[model samples]
Target: MNFYKNNEMVPMTRRYPDLKDKVKKRDNKISIQLIRAWDVERDAEKVLKIFLQNIDKLSSYRYWELLRSVWIICGTVENAQFFSSLMKSNKPNRHYFSTPEEHEFLRSLPDQMDVYRACNSPQDGGISWTLDYDYACKYAKDFQKNMVLNNKINKSEVFAYINRNNESEILIL
Candidate 1:
């Protein structure tokens, strides 16, 4: 993880004497621009592997949330380019982003990122579903009913979905 220092960040362990060996105290700022003006530091998991490193502690259902959070953080064109630059140097690890088309589809629409986690649960749990494809389709159809129109979305063919406190809805184009 990286640390914020002197209005900039350096590798925590090597550069920040105060944060040495204090992994929990480290700030994982991937983008200085992304930091809010009120908050100079941000704990972006994408830039650092520490917070999500406790994979054993997470239930199987929460895996998708973790993956989605990572993708959302590091799946930008510049981030992809940076990762590619590392690759050219034969770096051991790399990250990738979706194509513009795929990314646009995602950001422009409402996303049910935790559908996988919601699979095979009761309605009271809010959006619980069977993992089977047929059941998933039915859930989608039912979920579609709760959406409201927004942007280019139409009620008939949804482009976005918003689940309001357990009740679901979809908006279509």
Candidate 2:
């Protein structure tokens, strides 16, 4: 029987002697074995950098899949922003972002839709929406501006709270 590690085929007896019995019992259709965790403390930033570096080499589906995984694993605002940027770049054909579940996810992200253009105007020209050009332009621009402003306000509030906490700590000391 043949065994594989990291997608490379290897001799079963030489590579994984312990799995020989299991492999035989499974009738050669055995797939996926759990290996020891090598990088239990893997850095999220390093992983994101590596993924972005190789983003262009991946297919659209693969890219979205990896991005979703990164977002889930890292669960950081920066990762969310990266995903929004990727979505904006592919705005004209953002079918993945248009699905009901994905649309809800996008809506949940703060300031993500701010950078997205979903209208047909000279300034926001790409794909045409079903609404009138003037209405669409106004709606898109107003929505984006409000979202950005809200994001900035929320960030300032967080910073102010942190600063206040630090000031109180210094006073206690």
lDDT of 2 at 132: 23
Q: List the pairs of residues colliding in candidate 2.
A: none
Query: Mind giving the per-residue lDDT tens digits that candidate 2 earns over 1-173?
Result: 11111233312221122334543444222111101111344566655665666665554544554454454345333244445455455622233322334344334444312222223333322221211233334545654523211111221111001011111100000
TM per model? 0.22, 0.31
**Which regions in candidate 1 have their CA more than 4 angstroms from the true location?**
1-40, 45-47, 77-173
> Over the stretch 1-173, how does candidate 1's per-residue lDDT look in tens digits?
11112233212121222333333222333222233411444545423353245434332222223333343344333354443332233221111122233333445544333222122323222212121333344444554533221123223343223222222332211
On lDDT, the leading prediction is 2
Q: After superposition, how far is residue 149 of candidate 2 from its true place, in Å?
A: 15
The alpha-carbon lDDT assigned to residue 91 of candidate 1 equals 20
Error of 2 at 101 (Å): 7.7
Q: How well does model 1 score by local distance difference test?
A: 0.31
